[model samples]
Structure formats: C-alpha cells, structure tokens
Target: MNSNNSVFGQTLAQVHSKFIIVQVLVVIFLCVNLLLIVTFFKNECFYTTTRYILFAVTLLSDSFLFLASDFIFIFNIFRVTMQVSLCSVSCIIVGLYLIVTPVTLTAMTLERYVAICMPLRHAELCSTHSSVHVILVIHGLSSVPYAVIFITFFASASLDFYYQYRTCSVEIFFLYKWQDHVKSAVFQFYFLIMCLIIMLCYFKIMKVARTASGDDKISSRKGLRTVTLHAFQLLLCLIQFWYPLITSSLIHIDFTDLQHVRFFCYIMFNLAPRCLSPLIYGLRDEMFLHALRRCLSCGLYETK
Candidate 1:
C-alpha cells in the first residue's frame, strides 16, 4: 500500500510541474501579445490599415482565448468544479476563440491576396470599415456551432442540469455521442475551407511575385511569405483538432505516454500557434517593430 501511495505522490508531483510550465508559457505569451496590442493602438498609422486592424483583432481574441482556457486548465489541475452554466460560458468562449483564430488567419491571407494581386482596388475593398465588418461576420459565424450545441443541450436537458456542479471542459457540454461526430465534421470542414483559401491566396501571390518588378515584386514576395506563415499557423490549429484522437489512441498503448503526448500537443499545437501572430506581424513588420520599440521606451521612461 505504501508503494502505491508513493507512485501516486510522484504522479501528482509530475502533473503539478507540467501545469506550472504550461502556465508560465501562457503568461509569457500573453504579456507579449498585450505589448503588441498596446503598440498597435499607440501607432496611429495602424488605425487606417485593414491588415493592422485584423491583426489587432487576432491579438485581442487570442489573449482572451489564453486567459479563458488557462483558467479551465488550472481548474482541472486543482479539481475545482463550478456551476454548469458558468462552465458552459467559459467553454463557449474558449471554443469561439479557437475557431476565430484560424478563420481570421484565412481572412488575413485573403487581405494580402487582394493587396498584392489587386493593388488598385485594395484600399477601397480592404478599408477599415470593411475589415471591421469582416471581423463581426467571423465572430458571428464562429459562434453558430457552439451556440447551436448549447441551445440543444439546454432544450433537452433537465433544469437540474443548469444547477448541477461539474468540472469545466468541453466534454461536459456534450449532450450526445453524435455531438462528437458533429464536432469532427465541423473541424474537418473548416480545415478544408481554410486550406483552400490559403492555398489560392498563396498561388495568386506567387504569380504576382514572379511578374512584378522592383518594389512591387519585393512587396509581393513579402506578402507571399506572410501568407505562408499564416498557413503554418492554421495547420497548427488543424493539428489541435486531431489532438484528442491522438491522445485517445495513446491511452491503450500506455497511460504514461498519453500524458506526455497531451502535454506536447497542448504546447506545440495549442499555445505555440497562438504565439505566432505576434512574431509574424510584430517582429516581421518593420513599421510595427519600430512602433513597438517606441512604445516600450516611452513606457520605461514613464515608469522611471
């Protein structure tokens, strides 16, 4: 019995350490995202550009996603249960933002395509007002699946379901086994559409990159690289969709291996993709980088 107790203690220690490492990484990324967000606002130049606007939306949504999901993660670690309604709200927010990131990446790719391929109409077509409208549409569409699922659950479940306490995870919201299949279908459908959109944008940008001259060619090439990074980030999101299946298979093979796989997936596929947006835009864009530095210096000066 003491041997079993020792094994349990070791397992608990390992789990806590893993949770701390993940939490630290998320906090670091969140701080970087917040800094970039402040930089965006400080630079009035970003206000008029559609790309910057969309990027700001990505940062905002991703920040919220990290916060909400991390709360759930920490709660799971401590075995903290909450009211079903509250947990559902948190899970819905988490789901909404997960869909938003990839969809926004797709939109950003399309924006680049328009900027490079159709330079003349880019300003008019991809204006600030239009970008905001696109953002609203993205959120609206992303909310549909989760909203439908929740509505179905509430409609069918007893009123006691609302009052009941439960651990907050996506599984708690699942009303039926069919919901899993529906989720897989939604993820697959989204992946297909996003893949096609990014690929089309990439090829279009590539053609422009080959034919254009001097500054236009340089701009086209830059846009091509940006779209490629977006595609990679979207791929990470796609991998996250399959993470559960991967972990589930690992279960029968070895429980210890399953935990490792889960941790690896959570970091690489989940948190790392969220980290890319700032790296892509904040570090890569010279203008944004300059503005970020300026903001940071000013912040330090004020503090001093």
Candidate 2:
C-alpha cells in the first residue's frame, strides 16, 4: 500500500504526514487527560457533584474513542496493513463511541438545565449516583441498535478483504445495502432526538437565567455562560461532524479520493471533544483547578 499512488490516485506523502501530526496530538491529549483523572480522584470535592461526575465520564468516553479510532494513524505511520481481527474490533469500538457520546452529552445538558432552571429539584434529579446510573443506562440502551447491526454484519459480510483507507467504518465496506440504511437511520434519528433535547433544555435554562435579578443574578449569569459553552461545543460537533456525516449520503466520493477529508473530520469531530472536554468542562470549575495545582505542587516538592 505504500508504493506508487496508483490505488489512491493522489500523492500520499502529505496524508502520511497529517497522520503523524494527529497521532502526536492524540498522545498529548492522552497525557493531559490522565493527569486530570489522577488529580480528580485524589480530591473528595470533585466527586461530590453530579456535574463533575458527568464531566469525568465525558472525558473518559472521549479518550477511549480517540484511542480506539486513531490506532489507524499509528498503523498508517508505520505503513503497515492492519490485521482483520483488529480492524473488526476497531469498527465496533468506533461505532459504540459514536452512539455513546451524544447520549452522554445530552445527559450533561439536562443536568446543567436542572441545576440552573430548577435549582430546588436539581439535587434530587442530578446526583452523582444517578448520573453514573444514567451513563450506564445510556450506554446499555444505545448498544441495542449497534448490537443488531454488528450481529447482522458478521452473518452477512464475507470479510475476505478489509479496507486499507483511514476510514474504519464497517457499514461502508461490509453489510447489505438495507443494513447500511438501518445503521445510518439509527444514528441520525438518535442524534436528532438527543440534539432536540439538548437545545430545549438549554433554551429553558437561558430563559430562567435571564429572569433572575439581584444577588441570584450573578450565579445565574455564570450558569448562562457555562451552558452557552456547552452549546458552542455541540455546535462545533454539529458543524465539523454531524453536518458532514448527514450530508455524506449526498456525495458519493470514493474513500481513496476523499481520504484527507475523512482524516481531518475524524480529528476535528472525533478527537477534539476528548482534547477539549477536560479544559472546557472539567477545569472550568475553580475548585478543580485549585485542587489540581495543590496536588501537582505537593508532588513536585516531594520529588525535590
């Protein structure tokens, strides 16, 4: 596959370089994520709130997604052909991430909504244990559709040849035409429903926030800013990924011709949330940052 550009019909040197850059970024992201995890676990305060728990969950899920999907970059960097079993497992992991992420995000938004709009009910509705339960339930429920797709896939696909391109989607290369339709429809429908839930929750949150006045006003404004940031992140996901993903059916570009497009989209959409979630969501809390600083400083002094 590393020979002349006959198969892909384009110069692959640039593509190979891009893969290296992305993999380097992924390594950096993994390190920072690990640091935050260790810091959070040490502090009792971090686990006390539902929001923090949800933020931690998002960070963990996003990290796993990057690790699962971007192994292709490593293989591509070495100019190695991926093994069939590894490729199949990679496909399943990536699909699971795609479903799990939006659902978790939806839960995050709802948590924020209740915390802001319905402060009295927030404690009851959004507890650490309940948040963890919701995460488990979301993962469990979303697995059903993907489960059906995966079972049907193995039964139908010949699996004699696996894709050499950066795209690891099994739906595109394997499975019957109708099965592909079922897969895409499941993703789109779930995303649409979850997207609506997020927007509605935030909309109600913003309205309630603006109506507050006096001393409560300051807290409301902070909530407004935080919720807006969440919305912005979702908007980024929509533009970078969901829009292209939805419109993917419109143009039928061959994978080889559009490898660069898919490559960058995966970076921006798939990997970016993992990279940014810790900073944007987790570290935004002043308490978490202070705890992290103290932990690092204590460790530094001990090392000295």
Candidate 3:
C-alpha cells in the first residue's frame, strides 16, 4: 500500500506540473488576444459595434474554458468534490463555444469572400445590422447540439466522476451506450457538411476572383491569403484537437489506456492554434502589421 501510494503521488505531481505549464501558456495566449482586441478597438476603421460584440463574446467563451480548466487542475490537487461540478459546467461551455466559434469563422470567411468576390454587394449585404443578425442566427443554430449534449449527459447522471488531472472531454458522453452511437453519428455528419460548405464557398469565391480584372490584384491576393489562413486554422483544428478526440472515440479504447499520450497531445494541440493564429494574422494582414508597428513605435517614443 505504501509503495502504491508513493507511485500515485509521483504521478499526480508530474501531471500537476504539466497542468501548471498549460495554464501559463493559456494566460499568455489570452493576453495576446486581449492586446489584439485593444488594438482592433483603437483603430477607427475596424470599429463596428457588431464586431466588438462578437469579439467580446468570443473572449468570454474562451475565458470560460480557461478558467474551468484551471479550476479542474487546482481541484485535482486537493481531490475536491467541486471538480466534478466544474468539469460539467466547463464541458458544456467549451462545447458550446466550440460550436459557436466555427460559425463565426464561417461568417468571417463569407464577409471576406463578399468584399473580394462581390465587392458591389458587400456593403449592402454585410452591413452592421445584417452582420449582427447573422451572428445571432449562427450562434442559435450552433447551440442546438451543445444543448442536446448537456441535457442528455446531465440527465443521465453520468457526470459523477472527478478523475484527478484529467481534462474534461466529449468522449465522456460515449460511456453511455445510446449517447455513444448518437454523438458519433452526429459528429461525423456535422463535420462532413461543414467541410463541404467551406469547400463550396471557397471555390466559388476563387472562381469569381479569377474572372474579375484591374486593380483587384491586391484584393485577389488578400482573398487567397485569407483562405489559406483559414485552411491552416482548420488543419490545426482537426489535427490537434478534434482529430485526437475523434480518434479516441472511434477506437473505443479505454481512456486510461493511453492517458498520458492523450493529455500531452491535447495540451500541444490547444496551445498551438492560439499561438499560431496571431502569427498567421500578423504575417498575412498588412493592416494588422501596420498597426503592430505603430503600437511598437508609440511604445518606444513613450519610453524615451
């Protein structure tokens, strides 16, 4: 018993250390995002109340996930009951945010698509009022799957476990036989449909851009860059996060069987996208690059 207890203690210590590292990285990512938001708001060109609201919503959702994960990590240290509750709430919020963000991304893509591919219709179609309404509708649609998952999971009383150092996962739903098949099918279907929509929209935009002529060289380049950034984002999204989770689900393997590998992968996957996003935007967005330089120069001037 003493030997076993010592081994467990060592394992917990290692896991706790990893969790602390992830927390620190998450904080850094949030700070970067906050800076971007401030820079965005300060720029009059980018100031639209609708965009501000969307930014706020995304930040709030991301913060919830961060906080919830932090709580779970801290709670693990003491083996408290509250961890389970935090896990449930965190899972629901994270799941909802996951769904909502893709919709936002899709809308943002369409916004860029219109600005490049259909410049004449851009202002009329993507006015502030229209964008706000579209955002609301997108969020409403996204909430449906999360709501179903939350209700079903909670109602079934399957959220009782508070595993130490384990991140809350979608695979927890699969423990129930009915939820297992239902969620698997739903996820597969949704992923396929989303991929198809994204492909179709992108192809159409590219086709339109190719036919147009004149000083659209800049616009065409921007359009392609936006699509590439989004593609990279999607690649990271799938390979790092969704792919691992999906693999775990499809294999029907015991979570404990590959526990450490999954945890490490999750940490790397989640952190990579957050860090990569800012870098990609900085590289691809001339406006953002200009803003960054201006901010840096202003800071230097103030210091001097």
Best by lDDT: 1
- lDDT of all predictions, in order shown? 0.85, 0.69, 0.62
CA lDDT for candidate 1: 0.85
lDDT of candidate 3 over 227-299, digit per residue (tens):
6666566555444325535565647666444555655655655445545556655445666667656665866
Arrange candidates by TM-score, descending.
Answer: 1, 2, 3
Poorest 10 consecutive residues by lDDT, candidate 3 = 158-167
Name the regions of candidate 1 deviating beyond 4 angstroms: 247-259, 299-304
Candidate with better TM-score, 1 vs 2: 1
True lDDT of residue 241, candidate 2: 30
lDDT of 2 by residue, 165-251 (tens): 333445444446777677666666766776788778867867876888886677777776776777666655544335334445635
lDDT of 1 by residue, 125-206 (tens): 9988898899899999778767767776777778889899887777676678777667767767777888989889999899
